[model samples]
Target chain A: MKTNVKVLDCTIRDGGLVNNWDFDVDFVRDLYDSLNAAGVDYMEIGYKNSPKLVDTEGVGPWRFCEDDFIREVIPEKKNTKLSAIVDIGRVEVDDILPCEESSIDLIRVACYLKDIDKAIDLVEAFNKLGYETSINIMAVSNSLGLGLNEALKKVNESPVDMAYIVDSYGSLYNKDIQYLIETFKKYAPNKKLGIHTHNNLQMAFSNTIFSYEQGVEFLDTSIFGMGRGAGNCPTELILGYLNSTKYDVRPILRVIENRLLPLREKLEWGYNTAYAITGLFNEHPRSAIAIRKSNAKNNFLGFYDKLSSVETHEDIK
Target chain B: MKTNVKVLDCTIRDGGLVNNWDFDVDFVRDLYDSLNAAGVDYMEIGYKNSPKLVDTEGVGPWRFCEDDFIREVIPEKKNTKLSAIVDIGRVEVDDILPCEESSIDLIRVACYLKDIDKAIDLVEAFNKLGYETSINIMAVSNSLGLGLNEALKKVNESPVDMAYIVDSYGSLYNKDIQYLIETFKKYAPNKKLGIHTHNNLQMAFSNTIFSYEQGVEFLDTSIFGMGRGAGNCPTELILGYLNSTKYDVRPILRVIENRLLPLREKLEWGYNTAYAITGLFNEHPRSAIAIRKSNAKNNFLGFYDKLSSVETHEDIK
Candidate 1:
């Protein structure tokens, strides 16, 4: 409680990456209640992408996160703040209502460094609408030295309250995290720092702790590390580390037990060699994900050869 | 290839903690062949505990590691150095033949700080027999201030070739690893350093890298991090970091692919909340293992309470 650290339980939102955002409404609602009762600071329910901009069919209610649906699920929001992420160009400006008109309190915009200008515009739009906003720069492992400085400069000038150092590839080590955060501070010095880590190298929890130790405020986590590929750091580990009376780990654990544990069979979303290989090369995990779906799911060497045979930017590093 | 660091793959040895060392002979043989082909510096095939001192029933050949059995498996020993861990008081000294008479290249004694005297005695015995020796100080998280100084002193005076800072509970952070390695250097300055880490807080890879960065030469890893509780650092991750021609990552990947991946369903060994809770407290993972095997396996809160209810030295911290 005394600690300035804030836990954002993005179990539903980030986990959607692994399951195509197909969670049921009941699960999302219960997750909201559980996180609130757990004394977690925030709950990122899901993406706020416009259905018109992307296919909504077969996707869960959490994906669109219409104001009416969120209100219907949790008419009375409790201690936990409600939030959703919007991708650049994925959500129409009209899709975001004034914060006073909706239950959502925070609007997070996740985008690549190439679209930093657009992400900043969205952050400005949401900020003017009475909502706190954050900008997440994805795949920094690959984006470093490639318009990153300019993007960070642009993000620094924006009205974004928080700037997230997203480890989309899960390739960063301690030294790399230090270097990345220092660079982020050089430009976005005034903005609160957030850490969004993937567990490809099993460094997610440690990386999050490293972030907090370096004065980051927001920590993103998923239940049992349920997310795309290697998944995010587990909320349980984060809560356990914080060990604040203000944060109740029991509720987080209960949600994992009652709702998330059973999803393992279909999701297959924890740290594996495929993700580890991609992480090692500092490359995107799209190929690893493809390999996971193919007959060579467990064939690590085949995957390695397949990855090596391909000519790409990641191999140069 | 020229880093002077050594890789010790302990897939069969440490992995025995999960499946009661119930590995088939064919699989061990194939794994031995694979590690040799990979140019891995060392291959720890199994435990060298005396069968008479403990129960051998239901365990496999790896547990006892009979000299005749080892010779039969590796009829013509290749480039990989063969090693085995001997628990103090568990293994009969008469059982160990001279290094030249046996195929084993090294004899490692793993013990708690309280048993350091006994471990040193074993190390001396192994060294006298002309085999390189290392003393693995198990569960240093709980044993840090308790008898550690005395243990390190006795180990330093002993004829041990290497002194290992083992993180049995997988609770150590990079800073803690730094502290422990420095402590070992203080007492055992002349002895070569080694690191054996467990992955409870998901810091095994980072901790291992920290050890290497700190100049610890002997690094212990498993095929797929296949060990007790949260498992050891994966050999694949270690190889990925080394990225040298001396280490062929493909074979490690192949063993994991063709052999180890299939054992995952039967072995629920990896990072999980139960183990994470135990690790956070820097206590033994026996309670977590018990919780894992019980009905409340997925009940994180229940397991948390179960761990909290236990009043021991760990709670004081």
Candidate 2:
């Protein structure tokens, strides 16, 4: 129903955080083909971070996303463009080739509010290489007030193609999303807006739809909501919501049945009590993820009490 | 955060559809105590339908919700009130006792658009018996246009304390919810509004919150979303969103840890592709439910194609 909206499947990119970019080439190829058939605009394969800057002993090929490896996995690029994310310090300009020489189509820079300048610098380099670029401000819920306004102003002055309002904490409700959208549009009038949400309170799909209604151009989703902590919005849900003839839901359902469902048996990523607690407090999911890996994973009440105790301790200051 | 909002726990009433009301007495007692400690306003025990009218084979105690059994389960009343739902033709006038004599505080009549008159008749009878009454229009996504307006107008003239916008198909998005709330308000100005949603599209909790923002008062939830098919909104998520001192989420978490989590091992519920497909088509979950019971449960693509095939066949007519 929407003409300008572009759905980007970030299953490999965001889901990498949970399984450490361990997806095989066959699965990634299947996903690429399915996403292309489903008429999705972009497929964010994984991070494009430099291997020289960080250790990657056990990590999969996607963590660095070399052009040659990508060509080997996806020899034929379809309508779905390829994208890879780059954290501010982990990536270098020399690692990225010119867009005409590489299989990747877009390069996205993910950063916090404090690193907006750094993000813009990378976006500028990626733009110079003739690659589509975006600046994803992670954990925007914590970077509100004047700090966010200042960051948006900096991004507005950059050559980035788009700016993302990322709910990294998965803490925002509809009102918070609306307020952020308004603030981003006001401060960064030159940049297009995107929404990246986590399903901590089961608001990911709904909030993405709400954001679309409020004029966000790019919507980030993962197959079966596969990501870190509570996960991102499910790609199938968003595709179904689009309800346009341009996109097909059957391909997504096919991939889920053939690929993601089996992966679900070996990995766990979705809503639970621990993630919801962190989202409620507008905090990162590290503590919740830590507890989930421990023997006390099912101890939700104890987790709630511990969070509350920390809040009590903070109030004493 | 909201003073007029009333939280109602329908874990038993809605969840009974999944396991045929086979919950043990201790589980019900524990849930009652937990809901009370959680400061929930109302707890819908179960249906008050007459056993003589419908086949009660294999059904549990909740199908009938006998006053003596209710008193036995919950001997002392707490701050949380008790409620029961009844279908239009399944219940008899003589089956319900006076509110003062019975433990139930509210009697909700669930019916379709054609049965609104019958529902109002039941509500009037319950109101005359000194019990609070509500008219829950089932599958309201199918009852739009003039029928809904007429039903709400008829309900406006009744003694029913509240009227519910029930998304029985779980088909509605946020925009539909907002429009439905506006229409319900325009047609039933004298009655209070309630929201009951299913999680087929994973919009139950988010839609409930959106409905609250639109001035809907009564909020329906289930512990861990323990209803039939895709389930209802999780009680803990809404409680966490309210962030009010009047409610405590720890008790709900404790019950989920001890009871609901164990129950989840035996009963299959919550969001899945089959249910989401049914929701996308605005159809009843019967086909998806039947398929989930069949050997082809994991064949999501087949289910999606079957639904699509039906739509294409219907188009021929």
Candidate 3:
């Protein structure tokens, strides 16, 4: 299983959202080295979105990761390849450079249903720059049936190397994942499929396993579940379960011990009561997130009632 | 979903393993009242196994829950019923009193695969005594295939009202659970099925969902996951997900705030990496337990290699 499926570590990148991307260069360097040693196929360094595009004044380091910064952090690349994500509207076309000139091996574009055209433009540009590319359809739980069909058709026409099912709201169940996988395979049979899940419902790991069993090639994970709102599936969970001799989990453990553990003490994230409730209700985690941040008293009954009464909209707001 | 399925709160019983059952009578009384008000179906007060059997001298109060002690703890009977578990070999037949005279509503007999005969004897006794009886096969992961077949045969012949698929090792995935549920249903077609899952693999919630989908009627949970080796499934997760208007999660949340939260700060039991690894490997969590107890330096590579080499055994040992 380890030999067949590739693990992409996204702790420094996705986890940055939880901590406002306050990580230092040394932490990023250590994480890079550790992930390389752990046999991780890719490390998502950070978002490649242009700072100017997303209100840079209040944004953090992870909000706008530069190629120079990535180069400085990882002076010597090892077995692990580097990947950076660019949100459709968040990043400008000028930010992407060729893989030969930069350390990045893959440039992933994330977009909502309406932004598939914009995302594909980036994917094509990144492909022309001599970089492997992926288009991650975000909030896919809310994707219109025809929207996904259109996206898959566009992906088939583009030079993108991989297509990803992004559970941005962490709302997918195993059946939902199976459906998405089957749909993606039907439309883009030649393209590799990747999974990026959040643990809002505590189904991230299971959903990933379901996707893997269905033949997904790329799995995204984070150390200690350190991503936004309950975090991404823990990388260690996947590594431990794969049970492969070639996959050494020590480097991943070392990264957790050296970097993520301290970060956990500072930032509170993971499966909390609020997140669990939101996941169960099949609702967006904004209410849970709000409760956690404001220290507002949790009214489980009220929250549950609200979730049950209202059908969860594709758009959180 | 919540309206039909019964929830058994085992916070005081399973949580005692972590805290030594040193809870004061006041807390117990409060919990009983709170659980009743919250509309929980059953409240597992403590283990009825004899202290003489387990060498439990000087252990927590919950470790040695005598009938007299329990009688003193819950002074009044309410809407919620009381349940107590007795291990097959750990309990003496002479110790159990009929449910008619005592406040205890349910007498659960817990046994290993080899001890099902003893468990059956006790369940029969409890049934004769007019107590609702359940046979919980413990450390089920360790049961040999033949042993389970024999045990299921006994369950089919026995008069027990419920039979539980206990994931004692916290090692079962969804497919494993589905297999167990299907097998149990095949053998004991007339009996009610219960599920008790631990969060070691972080699949407890998902597995419970799987069981519920398969028509399991009883689900066991501890508030805030305060049980042995990664703890039980979080009750809040279930209540929130079931999304039934009849079951208000406020009472459960109240129990957490009033009892489990403070208890959590003092006693440790939860989803940690080491435990998650053990669950992922489908192995006993002894090494992970030792690591937590001693705070020993972890050797991930060595541990992974050792664990991987071992044949996949379902037993907790």
Write one digit per residue (lDDT tens) for candidate 1, span A147-202: 88788888888888999999999999877888889989997788889999998888
Residue A133 lDDT (model 2) = 94
Q: What is the C-alpha lDDT of each candidate?
A: 0.87, 0.92, 0.81
Q: Candidate 2 deviates by what RMSD?
A: 2.4
DockQ of candidate 1 against the true complex: 0.83
List, residue by residue over A123-229, the lDDT tens digit for candidate 3.
Answer: 88889999999999888888849779878988988999999999987877888898999899988887999999988877889888878888999999998889988
Query: What DockQ does candidate 2 score?
Result: 0.90
RMSD of 1: 2.4
Which whole-number lDDT from 0 to 100 does residue B185 have in model 2? 96
Q: Put the candidates in TM-score order, highest first.
A: 2, 1, 3
Each model's TM-score for chain A is 0.96, 0.97, 0.94
Show how many residue pairs clash in every candidate, following the order shown. 0, 0, 6
Q: B149-205, model 2: which lDDT tens digit per residue?
A: 998999999999999999998999888998899999999999999999999999999
- What are the per-residue Cα lDDT tens digits for candidate 3 across B1-317? 63468888888888887767778888888888877877778989888877678877657666556767777887668789999888767887777777777778998887878778888889888899899989988767667477787789889899999999999779888888888888898878889999999988788888888888889999998777888879998777777667676556777777776677777787779888778767766677777777777745344545556667877554433
Off by over 4 Å in 2: A311-317, B311-317
Candidate 2 local lDDT, A1-317, one digit each (tens): 76899998999999999999999999999999999999999999999999988788999989999999999999989899999999878997987899999999999999988888889889889999999999999988888899999999998999998999999989999899999999999999998999999999899998899999999999999999999999999999998998889999889999898999899899889988889988998878888999999999989999888888784322200
